[model samples]
Target chain A: MTAAATAEPTRRDFLYIATAAVGSVGAAAALSPLVSQMNPDASTIAAGAPVDVDLGSIQPGQIIQVFWRSKPIFIFNRTPKDIKLAQDADWQSLRDPQPDSARVKQGHEQWLVVIGICTHLGCIPLPHQGGFDGWFCPCHGSQYDSSGRIRQGPAPLNLQLPPYEFLSASRIRIGENSQA
Target chain B: MSGYSTYKPQSPFMQWLERRLPIASLIHSSFIAYPTPRNLNYWWTFGGILTFMLGVQIVTGVVLAMHYTPQVDFAFDSVESIMRDVNYGWLLRYIHANGASFFFLAVYIHIARGMYYGSYKEPREVLWILGVILYLLMVVTGFMGYVLPWGQMSFWAATVITNLFSALPGIGDPIVTWLWGGYAVGNPTLNRFYSLHYLLPFIIAGVVVLHIWALHVVGQNNPTGVEPKTEKDTVAFTPYATVKDAFFIGLFCILFAYFIFYIPNYLQHSDNYIPANPGQTPTHIVPEWYYLPFYAILRAIPNKLAGVIALGLAIISLAFLPWLDTSRVRSANYRPAYRVFLLVFFAAVIGLGYLGSQEPTGGYVIAARILTLYYFGFLYVILPLLGLFETTKPLPNSISESVLREGSPAGASAPASGA
Candidate 1:
């Protein structure tokens, strides 16, 4: 066979291989996320274990940020008076009322548990206490009461309370509640 | 030296390749010699901008997928993890989230530019149709991406929108179930939506490539709508078109940066802050602003299936624009009545979008229906009839004539001997 004739198939073979390689890469890249979703990394779960929080260091009526599973969880100790104020009939008149029965672990009235996300837009609520004694979403003017319930805001629900359990009088572990 | 050289003879393999596969010729035709319209304006830069934005989204989205969780319980927390733990994760998340809004903004302008210049007319019909397809895919991609957060708004928005499929006749319920991967928007729904959301952008990238290929094939339509006939009437793509596109892209980038840095959450809904709660529903569920006009159309009709069909048709009508507009002249610049109609059409769309945001009440619903009717009427009735009856300005002999008439210094000193 002539040199030109012999070279032609090899070039075609190269092109075919290149095309297949690119096609496979694109397909693999596309499927990788879906496949990963089906099989989560074991280390991620281990890393996301319930975080141990030091509650004693947090003062009454003061909100403290604690990291749990890499997410910011706000831990505020509401004094009996602060709790009474939040439970006042005036506060109850607001859009979202604070739950009388605790949503978190029982007998932890002093410890207020809430995920830091603003009930309005997902921006982490900045702790502000000018007119309202609670979190404020800077994005659109959504306000929440001290109990993490929507007060005079666009947010339709209360801030989330991550599942948690008290390990001792001064320490709590968020993301693993014994009370189910 | 001869022994060291050890050169193989022009292998039968190499020579055969050169004879059978003309790769150089293919590259030249596809990339180098492809004739883009010489008179294309700065407006045409948006197509390139869109391609760039799509690339940005895909790159950021791929990185995000590496960290995102698809499960309902973990999805919201995973996003939080990405923000708090992943290095520069906050910036990546912000850019991708905000990049979506910017992409839509560019496309809206691109489509509007097409309308104003009648870029969708005649020979460019296939190009416009491809653009419509790309646009539809973009909306779907955006919708699916929104559901990935598993936030309250994300959950309810998915719930509300997927239920629209339920408005379809008898098969609607089943279709929705299949879409959700169950009876309601749950873990399976989030999983599949996340998968598809990540997948659709690449599909959009493919369609956008086709869109540009079609655009290159037809050559770009210009402001004057007059075709360039000769070398004197046209400019090369590199220095002329490239510079113009670069300038506009810089300006667009500034606008994009301003949004990303200053008012990042302006486009986002508030309720998405709370975790997804299927038991509780938000009082008001509004979609992203870009979808407002169609949402208004969806609410206008009393019948569910008919509303869905109308909403679909509102988008599909764009594909028929080339035939719908029977004007011999393409640009609105030369068409006086058409220019007026175009402005009215734009206002009607904005009005519909605004109405879509408000509660579907007594006056708003009526206004939405009226605007929606006008929106379709602008495309179907006014364009075709105007093309038939409206008197247009006298035609310029070439792009050079139009440019000179507009008093551009560049075209002032053209050869005096030219006809």
Candidate 2:
């Protein structure tokens, strides 16, 4: 073979490189819609609009569930004893650590709102059950404290906190972090 | 193409077609005159039975899909309509539902037969992997199909299973959302699952073609674990193996028919009859019976991620069994120690299955953990060690010898009237 034949990149090499690069880009571009289509659509996203909940009738130590974007939101009217119990628990040694103060709205500690779904496998936790004065997930035995902190079982995290803020002393808007 | 036969088409048209497409000759060679071990037992019949079950599932599934609505609102009512309104829809629905259970039953037995005979050894590694792939596909298809009715069990099962992905540290939540096609398992999830459920069976059928092709290439492993040596050691596939396969298939059909007619809902959980309620999860959520053992395995671990990883490895490990088992002898009959361990392994599996059905608490959790240890140990430890330490019995010289030997299993051997 001639030295020039092996020394330099041939025209065919340029063609091959260009073809492969273009082919890969085309394939990825084509695949984008297939993957993108699986995401939450426009309607599902819009369905998550803020829901104003009436906490007026809710009794202390009582829990009521309401839906926002098809998810169960548990609103608890915390009694003094429940708040004390939640505050007294050691927050540092927990599986997922957060103080009772952090979980509830500041100055509105009497009202506790959390997404009722278990962090382990999305099963709804039964209210007012388990050793903790909060909720117990029956599906995999995950127990949460009155503050909805993970206390026991296989759940990796505490009950998820939804985006919400108080509208008034007895009213709250869920699915919105602040006044709209 | 084991060189078992040379096809000579009798008719001119057949000869002409054979020359062009050669499908006629291929079928003749692969099925009609293919060589199979003469000493194959009743356990060997499950492969044919599984194939028939696959056909039954696809045909019934296709027909059922015609009337079944995929929307969340209509899905549950549509199924009810099928049961109450559509002509013979009840029969079709019952058969399709029960068919999945029966299909798993046959595949499990077929897999057990393979494991016992060391069919995954050496030349058949690819075949075994294909079988494992087929099994995985079947599992996904079955899980998706179960969700189609939009029952309470279906909804919760979908939720719990999809939540398994969230065990991943970083990208897990996103993947789970992508899988759901929304924030939760809703109409989009159901629609996609329906589409995939319809798409997967055809893919399984394609892989099955590869599986059988691989099987024909390397040939079958027999109960004796000895490769057939000559014409005396084997018989033609047609008439001999075909007849036996048909007989067992008929027996399997009888059991299937009984389920369809008498106790149709016996295999199905009653909770599924109730329409899906996302807000309220059932007190105790259990998966389908076929998945019980793995469910038990998953719950056996205390950590969420570990449990998910363990559940995944439990299935993926089956694909690597050919290498994991270091034994040269294929048949468990010769490996006495291996045989005992194998039976114990089966017991553990059955134990796990039972525990999977029960709540994962107290003694059941402890028992499931112990059995889970045995399940992994049998594959990773016992199988490798037994192959090295155990003194296996002397093997039969050939398939013919094993069958013809004195005190051999009666009726297992082909009749003296012979092929």
**Would you give me the overall lDDT of model 1?**
0.75
What's the fnat for candidate 1, on a 0 to 1 scale? 0.00
lDDT of each: 0.75, 0.91
Regions of candidate 2 where Cα sits further than 4 Å from its true position: A1-7, B407-419
Model 2 alpha-carbon miss at residue A173, Å: 1.4
lDDT of 1 by residue, B215-307 (tens): 766777777788777655666454565566678888988888887788778898878878987644565678889999998887776444677
DockQ for every model comes to 0.03, 0.78
TM-score of each: 0.66, 0.96
For model 2, how does the per-residue alpha-carbon lDDT over A103-169 read when each residue is reduced to its tens digit? 8888999999999899999999999999999999888888999999999888999998999988888
DockQ of candidate 1, scored on C-alphas against the true complex (2 decimals): 0.03
CA deviation > 4 Å runs, candidate 1: A1-180, B1-35, B409-419
Q: What docking class should model 1 receive?
A: incorrect
Q: What is the lDDT of residue A158 in candidate 1?
A: 75
